[model samples]
Target chain A: MIASARSWVDIYLTEMRIAIQQQLQYRVANYFYMIGMIAEPVIYLVVWTTVAEQQGGAVGGLDSGELAAYYIVWTLVRNMNIVFTPFGWENRIREGTFSGELLRPMHPIHYDLGYFAGWKVVVILLWLPLAAVLSLLFHPTATITPLGVVTFAIAIWGAYLIRSLNQSSLGMVTFWTTRVGPVFDIYFTAELLLSGRLVPMSLMPDWVQQIAWLLPFQWTFGFPIEALVGGLSPEQLLGGLAMQALWIAIGAVVLRRMFSIAVRRYSAVGG
Target chain B: MRAISLFLTFLRVGALNELQYRANLAIQLLESGISVFTGLVVLALVFSQVPALNGWSQPELLAVLGVYTLVGGVIGMLIQPNMERLITDVRQGTLDYILTKPDDSQVLVSVREIRIWRVVDVILGFVIIGVALVQLQGTLGPLDAVAFVVALLLGSAMVYCFWLLLTTAAFWIVRMDEIVELFMGLYASGRWPVTIYPDWLRFGLTFLVPVAFAVTIPAEALTGRLTPELLAGAAAFALALLLVTRWFWRVGLRRYAGASA
Candidate 1:
């Protein structure tokens, strides 16, 4: 088991190095992509702060400083948690890209995971300076403690795990259908609404908040953001961490089962 | 005249190609419905706490959202799909076919493909605008109606020119679609009034990307906030950008022809 795990790690590093090299060729494209990533959280910050200001300096329990803090942290949490494998998986499967991946000893997810790892490194490198500039511009107020920071780190990592696994499972369904874009559209809408991408959960209706808590989208984005902005009670933090852990475990099992079935189908069909 | 004929012919062919997969229409309707619903919900959530945002009431903001949806639909249905195909064709050297054709290559590329199902967004936009107008009865005037039309037309022209100029960069750069995505990312700020953003961001939205002109300016017209100077500015900017993009496209074509030679 130890030897097998070591080999897998070696393969993942090799794949990540290759992916990073390929990504470097499209440096211009990546810079443009960052504009979208940075703009989304900024737009939300502007909208919410405007609402807050109109409501006499606080709305939904967040003053302008707190709102700014939440969205700025939100920028990092969002970038850390994004996984785009599902968007391309269907095409890869259809165009025989998966065939070469299948010939390898490792699971195909490892290949995508490596690519995502490299992508995250590249994006974070480009985005960190921008984040600093934004922080200076926004004057975000935070009660950031060391413990809170540690908890946030753990929660965001867990969030990435859950998100990646869930998205991979969604992609795995492409093995059966060609119409996965609509499914992703629905999922995107859910993320937009439930994940506090547009507004704070406190501002949303109670029922929407209830639904958000039930789903993993909020944990992937909102919980870590809120944690860093530092208004969460200890009990809430523990519950959120537990929920994220639960979702990660559930996602792993679900993804493993789906990949097994998908692989079986792919091989049976001569893929 | 020939350009119009070519555009219509491409529109028919594109419609037929999409008609082969009728299920997409239903899927698009579902997706558009969900987006429209989400927009309304977000508006409701915000307005629940406050009556107005930066002097624009909820109804006025809804009007803004309506214009945003409408313009976004037109871009998706007509502008974006064709521009994307143009970029791909350029990369693959399939653009030779269009160059050999008798009609203007720019017109042909600009109207090549249409995503028919995005009409759902257009219809949804109109319905939202209608509802908002009903709620805002008597608040809007005849001059406001004229101003909205003028702003919408100018805004659409500016947005189209901006996209064309960005995509025209494909002649020099291998991956120019990133710039297109950047424009789209900046365009999302149009979901709110441009007045709410910081001056720097507002300037970026207005002058750098033109999202303010495309969505918010029209909404401002409907809300009776359209200044004569701004409307004149929009007309001038739109016309100037149209000419600039045309010149840029010609430069790109020359570069392409030279590179191919």
Candidate 2:
């Protein structure tokens, strides 16, 4: 068991190294993608900041400073939310590349996790200079407690895992139908609204907040941002992680079940 | 006269090709519906917190959104698909076939591909504007209506020029998928009036990308915020951009050595 566990570690490490090297070579392309993504939260920040200043310096209990912090931290969480998407799955199946992935000894999810985790290192590094510029422009303020920092570090990885698992399940749908754009659109729109990608959960209508609380969307986006900037208490911080683990468990089961079902339907000959 | 006929011919062919996929209309409807709903939700959320953003009321902002959707629909339906194909052709060296055609290359490349179902957005944008007008008490004057149309046309031209400039970057850059992302991101800022952004950002949206002209000026026309001076400036800038884009495309074309060579 010890030997097997060690081998798994080695596999993850080597795959991650491959990912880091491959991604670094495409720095300009990756930065272009990241810059495009940064536009989203920046737009949200500007709108809310405008509203807050107009409303005598507060909106939904968040001042412009706090809103700035919420959205600045938002950039990092959004980066973490990037994962192998259903579109990738569509390409793999259409090109008959999934057959190669299936022939591998380990589950393909391990490769995705290791690879994207490595990509996150590059994304985070690229994110720092962008974050500094945003801070200089937006004047974001945050009181980062030690516990909050620790929780944020862990929760971002948790956020990454939960999103990857969930999206992998969504990718499985591609095996059944190639024309899944509408389905993916619906999934993304839901995540955009419910996941605090659009605004802080507090700014949402009460019923929307209640719904987000039950769903896994907030765990991947809202919880991490709030853990850092919202100054959540110890219990709330740890509890969010616990909820993330639960969702991760559910997502893994759904994905594994989906993989089995999808593989049975996936009869594409190798490329 | 020839250019008009050329565009109509390609338009008909593109429409007929897409019409075969009857289900895409439904898919487009679903996606457009979701998008419009999301836009309204965001508007509602913003207005609920404050009566107006900056100086504009809820209805005024809705008009801005309508213009944004309308402009985006027009681009997606016509401009975007053609530009994207141009980029792909440049990369694959198939643009040689386009160059060999008798028609003007610029006009030919601009009108080649159309996604017909995006008319859904174009129509919805008008409906949203209609609704916003209903909520506002004042009637749109005859002059305002004419100005709106002029501004809308000018805005579209500016956006087309901007896209041509960006797509022309493919002559050097090669992989232009990221340009689409960059455009989409910057274009999204038009949902709010460019005036709401900081001066630096607003400047970028105006001169750097021309999204301000695309979505905002027509919106300003409807909302009674457009000054003649602004319209004049937009027209002058657009004219300059057209001349520059024409020159730039020609220069880029000179650099293009097709696959045969």
Candidate 3:
């Protein structure tokens, strides 16, 4: 079992290398894409800063500079947590490219994982310079306690797993549906609302905040963001981690069932 | 007169091509419906927190949202689909076929692709704007109504030129799609009042991206807040951009033909 695990890791790393190399060839477009990614967060940061100032230098326990830090961290975490699974899988399914993936010895999830790893490396490298520029411009203030740092580390990893599994499961639904663009659009709309991408959850209505807490969207983005900037109790950190694991398990089960059914349907349809 | 007739003919052909996919109309309706709902709900949530956002009341903001939906629908219905196809055509060398056409290549390329279903968003926008006007107890005088129409036309012209210029960049840059996506990212911020944003961002939306002129300025007319200077500025900007984009389009065509030959 250990030897098999090692081999799987080696294969994943190799796949990641190829994906990275392919992405590197489009370096110019990739830089522009990075700028596009930062634009949304910057817009939100400026608006929230304005809101904070209007409310006399703070909104929901966060000052303007703290809000800046929160968004900067939010930007980093969002970039890290992003998984391009749904559209890629749906396109593959529609174009009959999934057959090639199915013919491979490993599960298709491995390729997605490798692709995500490669993309994350690119994002991280791109993020450093952009984040540095934003920091120089905005002067975001962050006070990271040791405990907060540790929790943030765990939360970021948990957030990534949750996002990957959730998106992959959504992608697997392409077997049953012809058009997944609407589904992806709706999912993005939900994330924008509930994941604290547009605004901090505390600033949102009470009902929205309550709804966000129950869903995996908050765990994937908002919770980690809040934990990073605002101090979280150990118990709350543990609860957040537990919630993340629960959602991850749910996503995994859904993905496995959906993949199995999709494969059966594919064989039946002879595609 | 001849160009007008030719443009209408191409539009008819485009309409017929879109009619073949009737299901896409339903998809477009569903997508636009969700988008409008999300926008209204976010607005509702925001107004619930603050009674007035940057001195604009709820109804006023709803009018802005309506304008945003209408302009967005118009673009999706005509401009975006064509420009998107233009990019793909340029990349694949199929734009040569367009260049060979007897009619104006730019007109043909610009009007070739239409998603007819996007009219639903435009209709929905007008309905919402009407409802918001009633809610606000605002009377639309003939002059105000005319001003609104003029602003809408000017806004549409500006957006089309902006899209044309951006797509023309494909002549120089191989992957201009990222730039288009950046426009989309920037455009999403137009849902809120530009006054709420900082000056730099406001400038970006107004002059750089032209979202403010597209959505906000028209809604401002409806709400009786649009200054004459702003309207005139929007008109002048639209005209200038139209001319500039036309020139750029010609230059891009020349470059494309030169490179291919």
Runs with alpha carbons beyond 4 Å of true place in candidate 2: B259-261
Selected candidate, larger DockQ, 2 vs 3: 2
Model 2 scores a C-alpha lDDT of 0.91
Model 1 clash pairs are none
Q: What does the interface RMSD come to for each candidate?
A: 1.5, 1.0, 2.0
What does candidate 3's lDDT look like per residue over A1-271, in tens digits? 9999999999889988987888787777777677777778876777667666767788777888888888888878987787766888778877887777888899888788887788777777777888888887778887777878888878887898899988988887788876878878888899889998878888887888989888999999988887777667878878888999999899889888888877786632335
Per-residue accuracy of model 1 over B1-261 as CA lDDT, tens digit each: 987888889889989999999889889988888878888887888788888888888888888989999989988899888888888878878888889988788898998889998988888888888888888884677888899988988998888898888889889886777766687788878888899999998888888789999999998888778899999999999989999999999999987743351
The superposed Cα distance between candidate 1 and the true structure at residue B27, in angstroms, equals 0.9
Model 2 earns a TM-score of 0.96
Candidate 1's fnat? Answer: 0.79
Question: Any runs in candidate 1 off by more than 4 Å, and if so which?
Answer: A231-239, A267-271, B139-143, B257-261
Q: Provide the lDDT at B115 for model 3.
A: 76
lDDT of 2 by residue, A138-221 (tens): 999888899999999999999999999999999999999888989999999999999999989999989999999999999999
Model 2 steric clash pairs: none
Q: Is 2 or 3 the stronger prediction by lDDT?
A: 2
- Pairs with steric clashes in candidate 3: none
Off by over 4 Å in 3: A267-271, B257-261
